[model samples]
Target: MTRWRFAQGVAALAAVLLLVALWAGAPEAPEAPIEALPIADVVSERLTTLGSVVGLAGSGDSHAWLGIPFAAPPAGELRWRPPRRPEPWTDTFDALAYGSPCVQLASGFGGVSDQDPGSFAGDEDCLYLNIWSPRFDAAEVPTGDDRMPVMVWIHGGGNTIGYAGSFYEGSLLATRHRVVVVSVNYRLGALGWLAHPALLAGAEEGEPKSGNFGTLDLIAALGWVGENIEFFGGDPDSVTIFGESAGGKNVLSLLASPMAAGLFHRAIVQSGAVDTVSLASAVNYTDEEPPGDSFSAKEVVLRLLIRDGSASDRASARFFAEGLEDSEIAAYLRRKTAEEILSAYRDEPDSADIRPPRVIRDGVVLPHRRLLDLFAEPGAFRGVPIILGSNRDEIKLFLSQDPAWVSRSLGVVTRVRDGARYNFVSGMHSDLWKVWGVDEPAAALSRSQEAGVYAYRFDWDEEPVRMGTDLGMLLGAAHGLEIPFVFGHFRFGDEATAKLIFDEADEPGRRFISDAMMSYWAEFAYAGTPGRGRSGGLPEWSAWGSDVGQFLVFDTAADGGIRMSTDTLSTQGLLARLEGDTNLDQTEKCELYRDLFEGSADWNQATYSGLGDRGCPPESLNTARSD
Candidate 1:
């Protein structure tokens, strides 16, 4: 079978087994509306350490400072270097509109744009942040013990796309929780993560030589918060950093980073994993004796050379690139435009699907040790309160779009072809995600740290079935479905898209869950723990213990409400269960095993090969390694 068809079949089979217990039934009736703070005009000006900033009106009783520059533009000579602080302004900076999103291929899912998907948009001068806070007098900046807690958000798009734009507006979160919210923009794609020996030749001796520039940009934003947050009524000492998906991965990178020490007191990682590329893989060519990634820096340069007519073919390009000195190579790469650099890695001219390695293990910005090892090692990571979680049906979001499992009508509405298989496979992948992203880290951190290490599983799946589209089964508590609940903002994409997932019939439950999540998140930011939420009248969220697997289950009253669960998962247990399963044939079982090995950080070749006659071909393993 072709790789694409094999992938679909595996997804279908794997998803069938995991959806037995998680999906909740439809609610009986609409409940009471959730009570919220009154909306009123508030102060919108603040004087930062750099200069004055004038903000604009926001939703409810909140003020929004949009597009406030935290760092100088990382353009031209600054492209791959660490971010620098913006120059002090003489005039009051007009923080009324959002800054341009960092350069990325536009898509329906990430970044801000009206442009068609796969088209290029955004700008390199995108080192800016947006802030939201409850209304207060301009002269009365909260100080000392009275300052509000600060929560900085990092948007997620595989660390390749997304920005601090309208979809992630913090006004509702800020005004509702009576706290300060900040969202930042960072460099992305090849510009943000390329690592090569040539590029490091002229670099400074410290973290600048490390090619984890996107990670550094986040650290720089946190540094800005430390110096200037008090003017916005936010306490720097009580700062919390939170993100979803790629943003969550960035948070994990920060936790593992020695450079980010004491910058933020708490962290929340949602559906994120620990991953980084080796220096050899970052700099080598894919066709070399010891092959590197397809998008390695040397390979990218060769592609650029061919694209620009500097060479006629791959062999000539390789000969030319290798003959050049490190300085010459660096200078040549630095001279290319952002579009030119990005075009070298495009799989399709009209598809934003490039997947280059990110978050390099450069030993300076991010330590050389594995992330889980750092967590287990005392004094390696900041032992602050942290929450790690994943959605119960995370993989459904992606699988629902796959033609092998789901079919769509009118190019919008969708339906699952085989609900049993789809649910089972999605569940397995989602469970594995939880194991990799949430459980493993929580277990490691809880064993080492004195500070609270909490865990959660989002299980709110109450979408109404429109026409024949079973959104409850199709979307469920899928990836990124919890983001709106966390922020209490349900507006995503256009009106029809929003309505398809979030129905008016489920408004009360949606509001209920969103309020609880916000309270728990805000309370965690205020104190070290989320005990009984901010109101001190919800279910007590116990910390993850070293012995038992404990985590709060977030759902509506109809679906068991907010409660605690002790069901923890591990790779060994999952593999054993897969081995014993009678539902899948030998080929299907091997396909699932292949996916598991491919997705895992701790790959055990012996264990995989021990699957006996059910094992995949040895060549498949080699292909996986090369890719």
Candidate 2:
């Protein structure tokens, strides 16, 4: 299509949206029963243009109307803009095959090819949501009854990756827990988050005026659920928001955002709850100084636009902005191709754009400037029940990405980038040094004190033989590994739990861990504790505080109860010395420091565990021999 024609088309689309959104989300009918199943007990059949698919598993009884459109296809002029509710669909749209994933570079193989499986089938017109519930198993609920709680899930992808497809589906959770499961697809990477000043201007007044369009899209998705979920046998009154990795990062942001208040009742943050690790990845990215410490989303958008198409032409951007009225924006975007629009809104974000990822603190979502303050405020959040935990060796996967680690698993020169690498090895020394001197723990403990906190550290690595290599040697309790154990759904494709990432001694290894994890997850979702069903007769856990940092420790041994480390206190004390202001730990800034340049690779001879036991810094092992 010619540029002028595209421009005209876009102008028309935007005009229509303004009128519609002003009147969107009117009340809808209670869902009707669609289908039933033994595995799920109940299913709601839905038909979309793509085809027919059924919504299964609500809190015992579920009501479904399939083919619901969450947002207008982010086509043509609407390409780089914030999402809009679809101009009401006129026909029975199919809801079976998940719509294409949002377009972007595929996930990193990182030598774990079979394990990662990267992303598949994506496009710009990808704004859809799926919901499930155990309640669907029941045909009816008494009127005026708020029986089931709701959970809206946002998958993790470093702000640029992840999928909403059923392959990573959460139906089992719905069937088992009898809660509403809502999984959604939002814009990712440059398309989803790049924030330019132009975007800042277009935002409406009084209703979440800001720059990060991707974050707002999620807000829009929740807005839809808040108004429509009750019809599907859900209780909007009490909702628990949850996710792992990048998803958990978002849970913190939503908890802080005033707009998200009254939208959820409880939350679950797994494998990632504290700040600093990826704290830079969250919200409040309004830093406009000469390339400051925090990331600036607005800068990324402009740079991407310039690199791709006519974004460099300030005049064209202004033209694009002016024409954003009526249905022109959405219509024009739909008519033009994704590749075509990609040019003006480029890809391959430069270094600056990539750093400022998911869950940014734009003051609106996270009013408290820092992590501790956000948690400290009583009125900031409703202080709901929370499930937060991590894997024992969360970084072990990356450490194993070294050549020696791969050689053991494959029994050959595998695809690792370098030879003989480990997180506590030479190349990883820099990251190791940073952790030793950091002190964000006190702030995190503060959050625990403010809310109902449940914590755990997963440490499961089985041994034996596999491909002539001990898989157990490759990992401990690394990031994202806890997910499968919780659901007992380890094998994603052909690879089983034992084969995918481990060399199990026997099949019992997978079964034992799976059973334990699945039970824990179900019990938590059911009753808010890992031992919710009263099956395991274990010690009662007391919530944590700035003073008492009690936490659950899941180990290879079944009876691996609680583990405490005084090291945490020392770490907190050291933090009292960096370059920030906080009662938590404010360090004085010094112009000169000892050994400013430490050879990272020096730690090849020392292990983190070895250093801790030998009266050395638990982190010094990240460097070379230090000789």
Candidate 3:
């Protein structure tokens, strides 16, 4: 290990030793005094919206202001409402500590740590944001009008289980790239998206009563940055909004929403598709149906009413709810705690309502239609530079969650049947879902808007998987794998998983990838183009329009690191390839087809419409539904 790494290890070991000694009641050891850290006063000489904030400096001269509240506490009457500005305070708000995460389901991730003394795993009053900056002087008191480009991060946890503190550690990016970094926390799960007629009835005049409170919260945070980021030496006008998965989905919503027109100058959507359900469909959530279709707040409320014995059945609950006066229902809903409301959707993991469609087509925070459809329209979104990307093995994360699904899909009966075919199918699925989801919208943006749209495919597969399991190969640049590399956060998430994903041996490759990725990202945030500003010795990244249909592939290679290539697969293309391979028997082809199409709504739709154009028999494309 390098000297810096060795020192970190020693410090960690010393911390462990200290903890053990304290637990064992051993004699106290002498305290080793350390030098004080550098700090920067983010408060400018001029008056600002946020009174003042001081940022503590880290190893690379990067300064951080943690847990700054961006909005008023969204509790009580504001539980499911749009976020409001925080009341200005006279006292200086200390931002050294992390703010509480919005109320969410328990995740095995480190953010949900009960062990941490002041961890806020499930707190309702959680509309906070954090900032990281590279500008610091000898006194480290943010001494200039030097405005650094800003990158605001929105973390991904299926819109249910992540916080700004969990996934983002921005010092590396800020210092290395000379950019300002901001990460935010918004409401999650039911608390974030709950929409009932009672709540709608209580809405103030001209206020949007859409169930997308989480989205509105993000808009408010962006507005806060626009109004107050100058104090932190940040150029709010050059802000780039980037996020992964659910966060990426939010970025897409922001692009399509009129309210977010002037909030950000650029956007990056990673592994998140532009898909949404209508408010009518989401509020009518149910459990009897399969996934993706049913996501009803009504069902949850029904379950709540039944659990509390307030109603005998769905009928009675409906009668009581529909029959009651708007004020009465509102009063009853407001009485229920966040925990009680979240409990209704916790037990059934397979239920359609589990991840209810938080992105609503409510014509307020979002457009009154599918995001993809909006992108298709000419001049639909703001003409901002955009980067759309997805990992190679995106489906592996979901497959790992259900090993049985993996086994059935891949025909892994004994000794993992046909590994090559399994890999092919997995790749095909990633392309169909993510590439089609991301690339299509990118193409739409390129055709419609003047701003450039860039595409990327994260293909890093060098990390070692857990011993005795094929997760390493299975999770080749899976859904969330690119995030750690992008943020230079190899040691993030839980310790065990962190170790599994980022081994010590892979440090060189990881570091190389991190430098390249951060350079590209920061460059994009700064100059509207990823390859234009301070490239840091990385190769050129061509824009999507220039290349027609190519993507920048991220991986470690001896010849060249990042290469441009086309994501070569489609729903029909894969089936045609499988059919052409006469070496495989009909049974194998059928099984592959079944796996590809079963509960695979898009593929099923294509096959139902007739696969004759793709040289596949309609009867041959059979699908089997598996749990």
Go through the candidates in order and give each one's C-alpha lDDT: 0.79, 0.46, 0.68
Query: Candidate 2's residue-wise lDDT over 116-229, tens digit each?
Result: 222232577778777765443334542256456676777655555555654345555555556566877777655665433444445555545443456666767787777666
Q: Which stretches of candidate 2 lie over 4 Å from their true place?
A: 1-68, 80-82, 89-93, 108-121, 135-138, 141-146, 205-207, 273-358, 403-450, 493-498, 502-512, 526-539, 558-627
lDDT of 1 by residue, 207-227 (tens): 368778888899999999999
Candidate 3 has which clashing residue pairs, if any? 284-296, 285-295, 285-296
lDDT (Cα, 0-100) at 151 in candidate 2 = 67
Q: TM-score of each candidate?
A: 0.91, 0.66, 0.83
Worst 10 residues of 2 by lDDT: 1-10
Best-fitting candidate, scored by TM-score: 1
Residue 232 lDDT in candidate 3? 73
TM-score of 3: 0.83
Best by lDDT: 1
Ten-residue stretch with the least lDDT total in model 1: 1-10
Better of 2 and 3 by lDDT: 3
What lDDT tens digits, residue by residue, belong to model 3 across residues 1-627? 111111011012122222323333445534546956444445312235857565565446666788888999999988777788898877666677679888865544424544342222478989999988874652443434458888999987777767888458888888888888999998887788877767777888777877888999999999999998877778878899999878888898888889999999999988876766666656654533432233366677777888789999978887777677878877887898876676676546332223434577777777776766677777776768999998878765544433443342232211224466657666666766554556778777777888888888887777553433344565567777777777877754445445445677778887888778888999998888888336656777877773376678888875357888765445567667765665446655555555555543445645544433343445543242211
The lDDT of model 2 is 0.46
Please state the error at residue 235 of candidate 3 in Å. Answer: 0.4
lDDT of residue 340 for candidate 2:
38
- What lDDT score is found at residue 112 in candidate 3? 54
Q: Which residue pairs come into collision in candidate 1?
A: 14-424, 14-425, 15-423, 15-424, 15-425, 15-426, 16-424, 16-425, 17-424
Greater TM-score among 1 and 2 belongs to 1
